[model samples]
Target: MRIGFIGAGRMGAPMVRRLVGAGHEVRALGRSGDARRRVTELGADPVSFTAAVGTEAAAVVVCVFTDDQVRAVCLDTPLLASMPGGSVLIVHTTGSPRTAEDLATQAATRDIRVVDAPVSGGPPDIDAGTLTLFVGGTEDAVTRARPVLECYGGPVLPVGPVGSGQRVKLVNNALFAAQLGLITEAVRLATRLGIDEATLLSALQHASGASRAAATVAAKGSVTAFNASVGEFIRKDVAAVRALAAELGATMGTLDSAISAQFPDTERKS
Candidate 1:
């Protein structure tokens, strides 16, 4: 595949390497000299602008940081128009479902297909080709995009149409945040019961309470350290999920309570 890539940053950089290693010809968008150098180092040809990424590309992957950035890159640029009629546009940012829907509508006019594929896991996961992708798009669109995605994805689930990937990612993040909240409470309980945090976490890892979150906390050796490392990203996802739920007149119920309790700063008061 001839691929166009945007946002070849921390997470996106690893993906570019994987795609290039998979024998795909990748052109990554690099707005600055430093950025271009980084892309070149990743073994992907560096392009100067967004439209250049789409030119003659089989699929253009947008792995930018946020929803607004994704909008600025895809909707606010000529990238889609520059793409070949049958090329695929794969969005890897986690954001509003409506964003993907809007992109899909816009891309349809140009005969480009859009896939919302918000990812879970980090650079290490991408390096291992085990990153989880919650994908949403038409079957044909997904089929076209799969080879590109499989270069660095594991458990590449097809959730539903256009926006479903974002919907599923939001829910997944919310639940994960709530679990962190529960872990916080468990730590507090252990403190009161005279059990050390490390001991409790270690015991829980072998019990039914074990989870990826628990294992992560164990590795960090404390809830505070673990939260400190991932708090900002989780906070961003929690906010997105909250906004999405409000737009749909849905509620997180207990999940909301737990997340708020854990990350009090994220709680939006009525």
Candidate 2:
């Protein structure tokens, strides 16, 4: 497989490395010299332009940070236009479902398929080949993308159609944020009862309230420390979910309140 990749950053660099190691020819887009060097270090051929990245590639994988970057690269640029017809566009960015739907509509004219394949887990998961991918696309499109996705993903689940992957990812993030909020309350309650944060978190792992979030905070020894590491990303995902809920005329209800407690001011500014 000839693959085009963008955003060779923290999460993406490992994916590129895995794809290259899987014997796929990967062209990674790197706009700067340092970026090019990083891509080279990952064993992927470096291309300076978006158009160059997608040219002649069977699949173009996008792993940019935010929704705006996804739009700028996939919509505002000629990368999609330059991609070969029948190629698959796999987006691992966690953002609004509408973005994926819109991209699919746009790509349809050129015969390119778009898959909203937002990922869960982290760079370590990719390295271990256990990254969970919530994929949304047509049967044919998902089939075309499976081999490439499996290079790094463990459970590459096809949840539904074009935008469903983003929808699932947003909900997953919202729920995870809520769980963190609950953990925060638990820690506070433990403090009031003279049970230290560390002991409470550790004990919870054996209790019914145990969760991946709880385990993470327990490992870090405090919710504050855990938040320090992933607060930016959690806030970003929470905000995206809030915006999506608003756009759909839906309500997050208790989930929103819990997330708000954990990530205050995460609401998208209009």
Structural similarity to truth (TM-score) of each candidate: 0.97, 0.97
RMSD per candidate (Å) reads: 1.2, 1.3
TM-score for candidate 2: 0.97
Lowest-scoring 10 consecutive residues by lDDT in candidate 2?
Answer: 261-270
Candidate 1: which pairs clash? none
What residue runs in model 2 are displaced by over 4 Å at the alpha carbon?
A: 268-270
> Which candidate has the highest lDDT of all?
1
lDDT for 132 (candidate 1): 98
lDDT of each residue in 62-173, candidate 1, tens digit only? 9987899999999889999899999999999999999999999999999999999999999999999999999999999999999999999998999999999999999999
- Give one digit per residue, the lDDT tens place, for model 2 in 1-270: 999999989899999999999999999998999999999999999999999999999999999999999999999999999999999999999999999999999999999999999999988999999999999999999999999999999899999999999999999999999999888887888899999998899899998989998997887889889888888899889889888888888888888777766777676432
Error of 2 at 137 (Å): 0.7
lDDT of each: 0.94, 0.92
